[model samples]
Target: MLASHEHYRAAVAQLNSYAHAYYVLDDPIASDEEYDILYHELKAYEHAHPDHIAPDSPTQRVGGSVLESFEKHTHLQRMWSLDDVFDIAELEEWVARIHKSYPNAHFTCSPKFDGASLNLCYENGVLVSAATRGDGIIGEEVLHNAKTIASIPLTIPHKSTIEIRGEVVIPKEDFARLNAARTKQNLPLFANPRNAAAGSLRQLDSSITAERRLLFVPWGLGFVREALSQSFYESMRAIERFGFYAPKILEAQSTQEIHAYYEQIQQERENFSMMLDGMVVMVDDFALQERLGWTIKSPRFACAYKFPAVEKITKILSITNQVGRTGVITPVAELEPVEIEGATISRASLYNYTDIEKKDIRIGDCVIIIRSGDVIPKIIKPIESRRDGSQTPIAPPTHCPECGCALVQEEVILRCCNLSCKARIVESIIYFASKRALNIDGLGEKIITQLYEEGKIASIIDLYALSVEDLLELEGFKDKKAANLITAIAATKHIALWRFINALGITHIGEWASKELDRRFGLACFAKSYEEIIGIVGFGQEMAESFVEFSAVNHELISRLLALIEPLPTGSAVGSNMDSAMDSSGGDFASSAKRPLENLTFVITGTLSVPRDDMRERLENLGARVSGSVSKKTDYVLCGSDAGSKEQKARELGVKIITELDLEKLIGF
Candidate 1:
């Protein structure tokens, strides 16, 4: 019995070490399969000897208790915010103020994650309760929801009582997926990840929190019964050793070092999984921090050096209606050229006619433009304070700007309704020839516009009918360039099934949905019943209905395009080792389904020699599903230069990771 107890303790220690390495360090010391084996053994031993099982066991992380409602709890320590510094001069002043008290003070800088703050209390190395940072002293109890976070360890190595303060955030990739799911359900989408995280945590049901996939990252100590280290850096390292994620810390001894560190973090913020608004600079020495003390609201020992705001004030020159590929006329704001967050802004999307009327936006009004992350510049609101009486209210267009077709108002959007509208045809062809779709190189927007205006290309099918001689009639066409474009158009005659489906530009059907549809139904997707289409995982009733509606409206167009384009045989859809067997048999159709990647899901990250879209196409062509985020369901991750959090998450989840060269080997590229 003693030997069995010793073995159980050993298993728990081993599992804790693996969790610390995977979660805190972003590195894995053991394979997931190996860890699982050990974890199961531990569970079995505990099951056999329940009396000997410790409360701090890793198996106790997932709680089964459900709560009726959240209760209010008082915090043991007050949670304080840090003073903000917007520029280098302000940061220098802060450093000077701190140095006056502690002449030899050094600082530790870490990311100021934009997220909801939570305070977690641990007793006897076991997590007892959790609460939000409400009013600094009192907070709503959320222990039930807190247990759902996988990154928050339910048990730690510390035997003393301790309270940890950390931020809860949803990663950017996960946020997109959550929003997409919400859109399919016709629910209002959360504006950003921070909002999503906060809403998820405040849910009455713990299951809702689990589904949102929130992560908790420790930043500072709230209270501790026993001191572990004398320096802040050392204390953070100790916290990490207890299996909690701590942000990357950089030590700076001088103002120049601090400035360089802040700049480095700002440049790399986008690559981080969580949203970061600034860097938190704090005195590294515990004694110095204690001596410096705090003000009524903020601590004097720490200050936040924030990055320049992505939002800027810009003037709207005019509002123009742009006809999309789907014939929906979207209002776009043409802005006076202004720089925001390193990019020059000239145009911002105003969404639809309803958005303009609701915001009271008008031509010649000054507007607040925001360029957050990789998203396009968007007008948040008009600066009505600076508006003069000369501002003209934008009226909805009565006719199509390009072809003079009568506009039809459908719900919140205005549409051209005419299939033969020149702008609609041009945009459709351009999208069909885009890199993510057919990948027809040399066919750009300008060239497509010229071809449509000259009546040489009226539809997507007309591109296949064009010859070098037909293109030579245009003003700027040269023999070599025209031949290259024709050749490029011909090369796109054969495409993957998913790309062909996405190229159709059906409403609510994006590249990801197209891939899912192809994986579920393959070539027979168009013929599937609405029930069958909606039954597929990750697809909803709205998408299935949209697909049926689109097919009914454009059946003839689809048939004509199918006649011109040959969709290459997919491994799962066609049933067999189609690539190799068909090649050996001189393109003979096979009978048996043999998809090597039938159940595989891949995620691509970082820069590759070929565009990421092209790489995704190649993988999907072989019957694989590509997702944006890494989860347990992910089969593999294709990593390239500068791969960031996705790669790290893959390692933590024990998903197979491959390089671009490795991917080529798998697909026989």
Candidate 2:
């Protein structure tokens, strides 16, 4: 019995050491097989000699039963919140204040982990309790759930009663996987990783928390009976040696160093595995920290220099539908103007009626708007908890709000089929003058709107008839602006055929489709039958039917536009101008040597050597059809670093995958 107990004790220690190396140090000392064998052996011994089981044994991490409710736990040392500093000026002011008290004080800077604060109390080297930082003084006990975190040590070398405070975070990958699992089970998705980590830690069942794969990153101590080190940075290092995962800390003596580090972190934050809201700047010397003292709610010694918020909570004042150039109705949330990352976001796209229904977004509901650098502002989810009895459900409109035309359902979206709808006409004109369509430089949406509203232009055809005098009648239209606009309009009179087709704003036909249709029919698409359009490769029934219907309905308009403009056949080698557009690769597709990728379909994904659009253009110029998605029909998937779902789909379909170098070789470049 004694030998078995000794063996069990040895096995437990070995497994814990392996776990510390693998989870905390990110270096595995033992293979999975070795660890599993020992873990099971310890479990078996504990099963036979149940009374001999240690509280800190690896098996105890996930062996707890579900709790009915969380018990209140009072922290021995209060967990103080850090004062926030938004900009460098605010940080400087904060440092100046700190300098007044401790002039020689140096700081320890670490990532302000955007997660739930946890206070873990260890008595005699064994973790006895863990709790959430509810009100800083007292918190809800979550010891069982806390134990499930692999990075959190169940036992340490410190025998004194110590209260270590840390942030419990889920790595971005693990959070994604958790959300995916929840999606499979039809659960409400978490808004972000911080929410996911907080929710996981609060689970009634420890097993649920264990499944989340949470990480406990110790930032500082609440209280320690014995000091590890006099310096804060050295103390954190000592904690790391005692089996805790210490976050990377930078020692900064001056405010300039902190600002430089902040800038560096801002550039590299995206590369981090977890979300970092900002950096926590704390006095490195424990004596200085103590001397600086505390405020009513936070420590005077430490300040959180926060990055501009990527996610902000705002109230949805109303839900409105926006009409696109193609008359596709998109539900847009008119939000209470909130600033996110230095931009005032007053509107967010709900995408469609289906998305509105899926997300249960309602008028008067508080919603979370997510906007990262350059990404379009979007309503992620409505905060259902904040909903009151006054909030109303958003329903799809039966008729077009602009023209009062009956709306047509197309899959998940509603479309305004009326070609003469005022909104549709206005948007179409804007789209026609867009860079991709006509390459019209001075004609923007605002300019087009002004022209439409002032009765200067009604349709795409009317744009060509505009005079400088007509534009001068509207607001903000000077002589130079009007001339520029007229010149820009006149410039598109002799554009490529593809641009003309794209400018038409036909339903289901985008730039790529326009290019494909141009390649196949050139100037003869208007005369082509529905069956012929359908017979074209990659042209589905919807696109074919839309083209046929559009051609039939707008035959007069198209004929008049054709007479007004000289649309050169872009894909064919006709004039020097037309040849220049087709020979983008400095080679002729109509050459005796056939285009290598002719009739092949390629799907491009991830961060390629060049821009994605450039790569797609290159592939298209080589006579290969570049698709947005991957399927069995795809001949090859041109992939690069960090390829997402499309690459995975290609793998599943057994489509040939090639890198940028391989593509260069294949193209004989």
Candidate 3:
């Protein structure tokens, strides 16, 4: 035991050193294989003796507990913003003003990272707390998530408490990878690296943040108990010694030097791994900064020279209408090709007819378009001064462009009510085989389009009828490719119930709602009424109505699908006699043994050992029905940490309240 303890200590020290070397120093002392072995060893030892785990252990980065909400933390020193100067003239003017006070003052210029601002507070050389720069004075505590960043040192060399300020940024490559993954999951793409970084840093689940690979680049100090250095540049350099990636900075003696550096960064911005929107120029002398003090919202000693907005002027070639999987008509402006931020901006989403009217966009008119990484290009406005009288105004389409069906207007969107619209059908088939749905690996939009145009497939049901011979008739299908596609389609015949439901392309029924429906009803959802479905947690009237309407209208199609495929019980039916319990037509059969909580209803609230969705699935698997709200009919409220109004409502109604351990006991653990 003594030897094990000593080994654990040694492992922790070695792993931390290795991490510092790799993440901060950019010099790896150990190979990945060596690191992984030692990491697993430490993890196994800590798992066996959890009480003996050290706080600074490398394995302690991500906490097991998920937070319900972030608590507000007051900053020891206010986090101030830098004043902005857009052009060289504005920058020179600011420099001239600064020269009036300190004629020979030196300045430090660093890239202004486009990301979320973070303030990390360390106490007695040990990392303690970290937060966002909320309102400069107070912020939300995110220490648990911050610890997951390998570059952030768990312990610094400084013994006294100090606050280190930095920006949490995702590299351009990482941001692109993240968006690509999100695209596969049918999730919304983040606008840019800045938004992605901010969203990642603020996740309640630290594990999600850890997966984002956020980097913290230290720029300056905040609340220091003891002074590190008198010079601002020297102090930042000193902070680098404590295991942090130092901010990229250049010392400047004049406005020309500062402008020269700014121009260099702007010209070579594409070569950088992370996003930079501007350059921050600060007085290098600590005494000068103190004397200059601050304005109401920003430091007077520092100013930001922002890069010009990433916008380009392009002529609108034509307007095109596209029908999405949901039959919504989106207006797209095809523009004369122009480059902005190294990406070709040939087309921009005009959103709808209302947006076109508001922007007064017209064909043949020159317009300004802006784009962020991974986000679709958008039209800013028409360049009215350059608009020629020959330009024609854009008008909303009276009918569906694909099927000539009369359109229905809803709020700001126009939609074709025809379910058989060719464009809609083609898109729906693509979505049904998407990664988040049935996930037929080789099936893509181009393949589906080719198949559809060839009259080999008209509907998703027709996919089951496809043969290798029929596929071989298409342009590029060799025997192997054709066989693989047929096999891939056949493999999806026995997918989870939730995945099958999502693949149906039902309106208002996304992946989450599909899982909820699967957990509660399984196959029985086919027979459930609107009241029954709306009673479940997070199921609104629109969703319940959509499900019911889709089920009713596509009864024959669904029946045919069921005849061809078998949806295995998911979430709540992974085990037990589910195969015998329910049939294709949503019929229930008698089981040999009574399931636990066979007739009970539960309402769950707050953070738990697992996510609330997982907890609900477990309860449902034991024959309990989970509801969204606490009613008099609720048998119990499974409460975890930070349980909110639902727990109180349960108490008011005299429903039983239980913890995770209590739940385990009930499950006969």
In angstroms, the error of model 1 at 96 is: 1.7
Q: TM-score per candidate, in order?
A: 0.49, 0.50, 0.55
Task: Write the residue-wise lDDT of candidate 3 on 1-669 in tens digits.
Answer: 225898999988899989888876668999999999999988889889999998789987864557867999999998998888989999999999999978999899998888899999999888899999997888999998999998888888899999999999988888889999999999998867888999988888888988877889988889998999988888888888887987678999999999999999999888888888889999999888999888656988999898877778899999999998788899999989998774567888989999899889899999988764334477899998996698999999989999897776666788774546777788888988997677787998879989999999998889999999999999989999999999999877667777788888877787657766876788878668999999987677878877876676566777778778778655444332333322322322112143566657888987798867656655655667678899998899999886777988888999999998998788676
Which residue pairs clash in candidate 1? Answer: 575-592, 575-593, 576-593, 576-594
Q: Write the per-residue lDDT of candidate 1 for residues 577-655, one digit (tens) a residue.
A: 3233323323312222433555478999877887786666556545577888899989899998867679888989999
TM-score, model 2 to reference: 0.50
**Worst 10 contiguous positions by lDDT, candidate 1:** 582-591
Candidate 2 residue spans exceeding 4 A from truth: 1-3, 310-669
lDDT of 2 by residue, 527-562 (tens): 899999998887898888778767776777888898
- For candidate 1, give the lDDT of residue 239: 87
Model 2 has how many clashing residue pairs? 0
Clashing residue pairs in all predictions, respectively, total: 4, 0, 0
After aligning candidate 1 to the native by TM-score, how far in Å is the CA of 645 from where it should be?
Answer: 43
